[model samples]
Target: MSPKLDRIGSVHLTMRQVARATQNFSPSMKLGEGGFGTVYKAQLQDGQMVAIKRASKENFDSLRSEFRSEIELLAKIEHRNLVKLLGYVDKGNERLIITEYVPNGTLREHLDGIHGNYLDFSQRLEISIDIAHGLTYLHSYAGNARFCSAFGKCSNGEAMDLVDPQMREDVDEKIFKKMLNLSFQCAAPTRADRPEMQAVGEQLWAIRMKYLQLGREE
Candidate 1:
């Protein structure tokens, strides 16, 4: 069964039980905490390092559903740009997902930093392609809700939003047309406008390749 269904069917457990059974976590191994849960830097008894994400306890079911969706979706896809899901420990209300530890930190952190090592146009193009490929895989194979899962998902999302807070910035003619179609197909008051993941991925791949090839010239 899918992780989402499994989580829903699970019986609730206390925090201590959750913590005790979680592998690789040490007292000093914390990374960060969010609405989702606390992330810790863990090293397996075999010396393999991983990022362990513990889901936060919440009264709301949507957040839990989102958590389950993320874990379920990520497990089925892999790409160079996407964070890898190594394994997971799921027992009732307490759940933990092991993932590759990206020490470079979140894209949001680096993008927002004052460092001169910012991504240039060419670099952005390449990174965009990478991100597009990752998203394409998710949409095509992971059965995500398309635009809901693609936008503002990483540092680029925040950067893009910050640069064009209103999303009114001008784009190329071809890109503009494609974006319009995406809006018509995926952005709707009703969920019916959402397209199949395969179609969404293809569209993203086409646009991303167009941008990436433009970078090759520079």
Candidate 2:
């Protein structure tokens, strides 16, 4: 095992094992595609369901360094909203990342009505708060430099505009504004001006609670 994999205590799987589990990357097993590569659903010998991300042959060499760095980073961070990295495979030209299977699907999929499930206003608020909490954990525990990329994305000051159209109507404007304000703070030009993740999480939780209380009174 490589030092990075050793540090993370990640399980190392052989190419044959991965191929067997994925039925040699059968089309039906393919889950999704991303910048990293293709994702597939696999069932391990022990009956554990996992999502495997395989790097494209064209990008394999170029992404090796990034893949290792990501493994090292993910191994050290643990959060409810963040997917857990279960293992990895690096053999010849093959590079793969294994993670726990999330059966419910992506938040975008739910919002887009892919699974016949639509989130209500309260549910959407809860999800927003969850994201804030996760971000808070990443910022506070992992150090600012480690999360600079994420911070940069929020720097454009268009955070509120990214809200889903389906969630626009029937929103608690008061709470929504509070969440928006928090986003701006997190995206502050100066890192010192940004509130610690703990504070961000607390504020988000408070907004969620306030919204829930108002719901109870109505």
Candidate 3:
């Protein structure tokens, strides 16, 4: 909700309007399907591009209960890296969360060379910092981070095995090693052993500055 809509502020959209924009939920408009439901990309009549996340039909009641909070919490997020909530449709059992569309494919896609050119080491490093910043903001705003401790599953594997194959040409072993160490520290098995997100963001920035300094020296 928009916050202005009902305390949720999300605009109440009619199923007819959504159907019209989505070509009656045509398969062609589908961007992806996930555990919740399908996501569709559409251009609204006002020329606004948006991603619509429709709830799964199979588990209507439970899914509705689940996504209700998702809609509310997501609407509170205003960071650039995070998607912006626009409006929603709650008519009948048709539940949808509409958000501003980001044209760039997922980070995984760029890593795999699926949507963009392969990411160089510098690009990958900057992207990692961006992720850390996003996490910092999320942790600060949400306040309750029960899942932050779950990041311990990541691994450095063997020394060379952890590096992205695409970044072999420009990867800096020292900087990469520091990043891997920080990641491992974050994923420490015990919650008490993990660094705070704010601290993580700081270390990422410091590493990024060193990377740039080395670039200047080179």
Off by over 4 Å in 2: 1-10, 139-218
The digit string of per-residue lDDT tens for model 1 on 1-218 reads: 11332332222223453354344355577878866688887654455566777777663355555666566666666577777776665656656776778877666665766444776788778878888988777665654344545444422433233234466644455554566567557755446667877889888898889877766765
User: By descending TM-score, how would the candidates be arranged?
Assistant: 2, 3, 1
Pairs in clash, predicted candidate 1: none
Tens digit of per-residue lDDT, candidate 2, span 103-160: 8887889898889978899999999999999988776655544555444544565444
* TM-score for each of the candidates: 0.47, 0.60, 0.57
Q: Give the alpha carbon lDDT tens digit for every residue of 18-132 in model 3.
A: 8878888899888888877899987777776788889888857887666666666666777876777887776677778887788886677889999658999999999899889
Full candidate order by lDDT, most accurate first? 2, 3, 1
Range of the 10 consecutive residues with the lowest summed lDDT in candidate 2? 1-10
Candidate that scores best on lDDT: 2
**Winning candidate number (TM-score):** 2
